[model samples]
Target: MKKKCISGLVMLLCVMLVSTSVLFAAGSKESGASNEVDKIKSRGVLNVGVKVDVPGFGYKDISTGANVGFETDLARQIAKVILGDASKVSFTPVTAKTRGPLLDTGELDIVIATFTVTEERKLSYEFSTIYYTDAVSLLVKKSGGYKSLKDLDGKTIGVAQSATTKAVLETEAKNQGITLKFSEYASYPELKVALDSGRIDSFSVDRAILMGYVEDSSEILPDKYSPQEYGAAMKKGNLALLSVVNSTIADLDASGELLAMKAKWGLDK
Candidate 1:
């Protein structure tokens, strides 16, 4: 009888150990599956990286002192989806040079700052469905009389550093057999200043961003050198988070909210 009791206790201990192992495995799977989305929901705030200077896309309005633009609208919509309130968002101003690194290090939950999706960028980060499409264009002083890309041959173009604009422009120039000079700035505001001050003959970037800065004295050239598709960016392998963003985009598209946003921001189509 003593031997039988001992054997029963040993079996009970084994069962308990197996049960604990299964529970731990289940808990880990749940945690891993919902890591990013669960964290954001728990925080009650969605942290978005956006541009404060680029007009119509993601600009901080001076009168209201609030971030306002097409991308801003999308970010707020995302906040509404994730947190059940559109106001629960913190917009972190990020430039072309900093946006990717910030997203990589978890400083930003999403980047909607006119982020262009490209094969090269895809290696480092994943992007949601294309939310908006833009084209690379030239913004020149009205007096410059630059009517065509060929006319700008040998002229200096100001572009945002670390942006795809530079590469796109270079490729276009080479394909057209036009020799050009490029001056790189860290931000769109700097490029605007350079173009305004006559330091650079033209400012090259996405037409969506250039439209925000165009004044009566400046005009965008008619030619679109390259096409750009803007998408929301996040760290790679976050399919849960990516799915959420994609669904938000799809909802916006289906509800015509995306087109409404573009109209509000003066984006063409």
Candidate 2:
């Protein structure tokens, strides 16, 4: 009977150990499953990366000292959905080259600055559903006699650094049996300055963004190539925030609010 009692106590201890392990694992999972949404909510603000130079997308208004435009408004919408207030957002200016690294370092919560989505980029970051679509085009001085991509055969085309424009133009140039040289600038304004100063024969970027840079001396060519899809981007593994962002975009799109917003900014075209 004493031996039987010892076995019973040992079995009880064994069962307790197993149960404790199961409980610990459950607790660990619950802790590990914590999402970024909770953090953003705690912070009470949505930090977004945007462009300050691209006029209709996300730019600082000189007269009003306000960050205004389509993408800026989009960030506000996300802020409203997440924080219950449209004004609870802070905008950080980002360029094509810096946005990704900033995201990696956790400096920005979301990027809404005309961030083009690609398969390769998807590997490094989480992108929301395509919010806008555009075709890559060329902007050149009107006096350059540039009617299409064919005109700048051996000349240099200026593109924003870390943008998809160069690859896009190269593919089209190859298809048209043309060899083109490319100069990469850090910002659209610099590219525009380069074009204006005869440093580059053309300024190339998405048509919508290029529209913001067009000057009296420059004209966007009639040729369009490679449809670019813009989406809000976040850090890799940020599934929680991504889901909310995607849902917000879907809800706004369904309500036709986004279409109207685009129209308000003359982007409905």
lDDT of 1 by residue, 64-90 (tens): 999999999999999898889999999
Model 1 stretches with alpha carbons more than 4 Å out? 1-33
Model 2: lDDT to the true structure: 0.91
Candidate 2 structure quality by residue, lDDT tens digits, 93-208: 99999999999998899999999999999999999999999999999999989898998999999999999999999999999999999999999889988998999999999999
Worst lDDT run of 10 residues, candidate 1, spans 25-34
| Model 2 bad stretches (over 4 Å) | 1-34
Q: What is the lDDT of residue 181 in candidate 2?
A: 98
- Per-model TM-score, in order, reads 0.88, 0.89
Best of the candidates, lDDT: 2
